[model samples]
Target: MPRAPNEKAETAKQMYLEGQKMVDIAAALDIPEGTIRSWKNRYKWNATLQKDNRNVAKKCGAPVGNKNAAGGPPGNKKAEKFGFFSKYLPPETKEIFDAVQDADPIDLLWHQIQIQYAAIVRAQRIMYVEDQEDSTKVTSMESAGSEAYMVQMAWDKQASFLQAQSRAMKTLQGLFKQYDELLKSDLATEEQKARIDRLRAEIAKVEAENKERAGGEQPGDDGFLEALNGSAVEDWADED
Candidate 1:
């Protein structure tokens, strides 16, 4: 006699199709293994799951019968964890973000600067598209003028963003200069300062000596000495 369609069998079939072994599924679901095995055989669960797996792999362009090394299938947990945002961002922005993601003061400053810069670029693109875009083809001349005004307003916003960005950079420069002065005030001892001054003096002396030597010699002096010494050595060799 055919058992009526029921919840237990349906549950058993679902667990078996999910790649769980019959014994484990039976243990976890508190059902007998023989009953689950019966459900598996009756529902043709293995064949159905195999077909589904092959279909999934084909859709993802993965070779048949090969499990992914990173895990099973594309868009698996690991790949998303590693680079979920990589393809969505512009290459240069992605590169800048990646390079500065964990870096220090420069990263913070770069982040501050790029926020305004990105806003300016977005505003410019909007303005460009608006200017070139035909306004529904049925727009009145006044509407066209209004659209032009809107684009010009967006362009004005972009200019404001750029000027703000420049002011931010200059402010950041001053802040950094103050920071450097603070670090120097706390960290530099008199001895280190004296040594630094002495090193600078020595570098200046060496640079001056090099400059003097470079211009002091006549252009042909080295060649003339070489020729004069060459004949003297030959005469000495002939005497020997």
Candidate 2:
């Protein structure tokens, strides 16, 4: 009497098997191309997509590699040999590491990190000073005492740069610790560890110089932060 729904689906499947594109099959059966593709995907019929029958090898019993393709060993020896480290760090990560090989990766990364940290400290100080400066301008000072208070506040902010230098020192120390841990573990290679050690020494020297400068000066206005935040913030706030 009536054909089964499964029977209709099977017939559609057979049409797909018999050299029919998804679009052609969908048009013929009044079904969507997505439905046809779904059917093909469910059945794992990969051959229907190929233009030539030569490329359509057996799905279950296929050779590992083609004999025609060149060289002694087909797969990459370097990738296969590197075990867990290679599995986590694929070719793409290795390529990035390779690109920065000439310069010390640890040193470069630490410098970048320190630069970012210094920028942040400088920014915070700038914001604080601008807020104080704006307050001085906005408030009506009837006395020299009020004027002196505003001046002191500005001076305090300039001096706070010395305090911020300590923060920079702490940041470098933390990074050094992290770099040391990373190097000591199996995560990085010997070359990476050596570079990290070299970078650590350079960073330590920089921090020491900054410490000496901060210690030698007065606490608030005349320190390292003032020098950095000087005309830059003035220009930034002026622009805004």
Highest-TM-score candidate:
2
RMSD of each: 26.2, 17.0
- Give TM-scores for every candidate, taking all chains together and pairing residue i with residue i: 0.24, 0.29
Native-referenced Cα lDDT, model 2: 0.53
At residue 221, give the lDDT of candidate 2: 33
* TM-score quality measure for candidate 2: 0.29
Best candidate according to lDDT: 2
| Per-residue lDDT of model 1, residues 185-231, tens digit only | 55445653354345335535544564578775332122212211222
Give the clash count for model 2.
3
Q: How displaced is residue 24 in candidate 1, in Å?
A: 1.5
